[model samples]
Target: MSQSIIAKRYADALFQLGKERSKLDQFETELLTLREVYRDNNKIVSFLKHPRVSVDQKKKVMTDSFQSFSEEIVNTLKLLVERHREDIIADMIQHYIGMMNDAKGIADADVYSVRELSEAEKQRLSETFAPKVGKQSLNLTNIVDSSILGGIRLRVGNRIFDGSVSGKLRRIERELVSTNKR
Candidate 1:
């Protein structure tokens, strides 16, 4: 199945469970931890993705490997592995977090820059995002795009803030054309 459909189901189910249990915040942190676990362990990911391995074996490993987490996470993950939807596990967790964020009125921002910014620069950017967006805080994703030449561009949902040098140049050219036409 496509990532969208998978994400929707996984996200919705997790969201509902979190709400019911009042462990939504815990689930958020644990989900991040799980995503990291999957990302860092290529062997584990490959093992899960391999068609030859039965889902039974997968569940047993999960129960053994991550014995530290809550029973809720453990059981939920078991269900995922059992259903053979482990491939989209990371995305599903993320989509669920996103949905929860939206329900809480949180804004997600995508920041694009020609070069990676330092930690201080990131903090400053968040401070700037607040007044500009009229939001108390933002959930920002940093993206590096060297092709931008220089500067930063940000997108929050439907709104886009273009400050990249290449973007500015394009806008300037468009303005010049419109002015000449006028």
Candidate 2:
């Protein structure tokens, strides 16, 4: 199976477990932390994936590194090591987070602007766009991209609402060119 499909399966199972246990937030947090740890430490991931390293040793390392995490989280890490699927940890965590966000009617958005958006601006954008996207609110991550020139571009999932000056100029140019050609 594709790695993403496998990861989604694991994420679904974990999500179901989280829901049943009423620990959705806790599980997502733990998994995100684990994902960050592996992401930031290439050596640890390489060590775990080494052919010579035993599963027990890898599990021990995981236990030591994540000792404070809940048993369910630790066991899931050990399970991934045992199955030689440790590489999917990050994907699984992402899918789990998506699931959590969907459950809460929240959408994660990337908003690109020429300058940093103030809290009030962000809140206004969230309120204005969230309803359009059928989401309760947007968890906005602001990115300053000077290329936008002015205005902002908002991306929620695969949809983009490009209100940037550069984007408008491009659209107008396209329209004018098409009309002239006709």
Candidate 3:
């Protein structure tokens, strides 16, 4: 099977387990932390993938590194190590988080603006855009992008809602160019 398919299967199983244990939120948090660690430390993944390293040592390292995490997550990591599937760890975590977010009616969004958005502004944006995307709310991540010049540009999944001044200008320019060509 493909890597993404395998990862999704593992994620689905974990999601079911989390639901059964009433720990979806906790598992999501732990998975996010694990993803961060994997992203910031390439050595850990390399160490786990190294041919010279034994499976026992890799499992021990994972357990020791995440001793405080829930048993489900730790065991999952150990299982991945044993199966020589360390490369799919990040993808599995991402899939798990996506599943959790879907279950919670939440969508992750990136809002680009000239400056950092205030909490109230973020909340307002979430309130306004969430319903449009068929979500209860948005987990907004504000990205300060001066290139947008003014207003905000919202991105959710594959859609981009461009309300920025730069975007408007671009649209106008495209229209003018097309008209002139005609």
Tens-digit lDDT track of model 1 for 134-157: 766677788999988999999988
lDDT of 3 by residue, 1-182 (tens): 99999999999999999899999989999999999999999899889989999999999999999999999999999999999999999999989989888988999999999999999999999999999999999999999999999999999999999999999999999999999998
- Model 1, poorest ten-residue lDDT window? 130-139
Candidate 3 error regions (>4 Å): none
lDDT of 2 by residue, 1-182 (tens): 99999999999989898888988889988887887887788999899889999999999999998999988888888999999998888898999999988988899999999999999999999999999999999999999999999999999999999999999999999999999999
- Relative to the true structure, candidate 2 reaches a TM of 0.94
Q: Which structure is stronger by TM-score: 2 or 3?
A: 2
The order by descending TM-score is 2, 3, 1
Q: What local lDDT does model 1 show for residue 77?
A: 83
lDDT of 2: 0.93
What's the true lDDT of residue 134 in model 3?
99
TM-scores for candidates 1 onward, in order? 0.81, 0.94, 0.90
Show model 1 residue runs off by greater than 4 Å: 1-3, 114-120, 131-134, 142-151
Model 2 stretches astray by more than 4 angstroms: none
Q: Superposing every Cα of model 2 onto the true structure, what RMSD results?
A: 1.3
